[model samples]
Target: MQRVLIVEDDPLIAIDLQHMIHDLGYVTSGIANSFDSAKRLAPHSDLALVDVNLVDGATGPRIGQFLAGEFGISVVMVTANPEVVADGIFGVIGVISKPAQPATIKQVLEFMSTYKHQLVAHPPALRLFTCDRRGPL
Candidate 1:
């Protein structure tokens, strides 16, 4: 089973994400509201669902880079601000907008599970990026 770590600041949102992930048949490694907690839990996860504006300011991009580059973890940015993708951070495989529906989350995760190496996007909704292909959605 794939283990996912959620890096979200809002406790309620994190819980909702956890429930969604569980419903999709993936294991929730844990939830982190800040960079420090994310760093600590990154090692135990296969993938990470990150929020752009974390409790510690806008550090989600940095955390995503670290988790992907250092730990070889797959990263998907889940944020209200999709502009973070413009930053061109490394190791982010995809971006999912905030308030993600169960179907959307399931779709993204299904894509991640299959095309873990390629850059895949769900369009106007979820945008994906890979090292080979990097640009705005």
Candidate 2:
């Protein structure tokens, strides 16, 4: 199962995205309203649904960069801002428009399903962490 982390500030949206992830047979690791919580969970996540703007106005691109570069988690950016996605966005595998629908979220999962192996640091690393999903993580 894919260990997915949601980085959305809106509680309802977070819940909805979490459900969408589960429907796709992926497990949600956590919910992060800000970049800090997101970064803290990146080490364990395989896929991330990152919002472009957080509570503090910080952008998700920063979080996306960290997830891909440091933690190796695949990132899917959800944004309504064109400028936010403009010119040389890196690390994220795909972009979804804001108010992301179930289908859009599903597509993101499809994009991430390919990298589920990275969700775990290593085969033996499973003994070192607790996975939210069943099976060997």
Candidate 3:
């Protein structure tokens, strides 16, 4: 089972995401409301669902970079602002828009599980950022 970390500020949303992750057969490593907390939990998780805006402001990108660069954890941006992910932030595998459906979440996870090194987008509506070993694809 893949361990996933939820890096969201909203307690309610975090709980919902936790349930969704569990239902999708992924284990919940932990939930972190801030970047510091996320850093502490990064080592234990295989992947992370990061929100662009958190309790510590818009620090999700930084956290994603740290997790992927320092710990080799996969990151999928789950946020209202998909544009942030479109900025071509390093370490982010993909972006899933806010109010994610269960199906979309599952699809994203499956894609990640198969293509761990490449970037992808969920729901097909959002822009996909693909990358290869050399660079963006």
Best model per TM-score: 3
Prediction 3 global C-alpha lDDT:
0.81
- After superposition on all CA atoms, what RMSD does each candidate show versus the true structure? 2.8, 10.0, 2.5
Clash number for model 3?
0
Question: Which model scores highest in lDDT?
Answer: 1
Pairs of residues clashing in candidate 1: none
Better of 1 and 3 by TM-score: 3
Candidate 2, residues 1-137: lDDT per residue as tens digits? 77999998888888988888888778999999898899788877988878878886766878877787777787767766635565424666546666767776675576466545454222111111122222232
Q: For residue 6, give model 2's deviation from the true position in Å.
A: 0.7
For model 3, state the Cα shift of residue 24 in Å: 1.3
The TM-score obtained by model 3 is 0.88
Candidates in descending TM-score order: 3, 1, 2
lDDT of 3 by residue, 18-136 (tens): 99999888998999989899989988998888898998999998888788788888788888889766865676776888899988888877776667555544447334557522257
TM-score of each: 0.87, 0.77, 0.88
| After superposition, candidate 2 runs with Cα above 4 Å error | 115-137
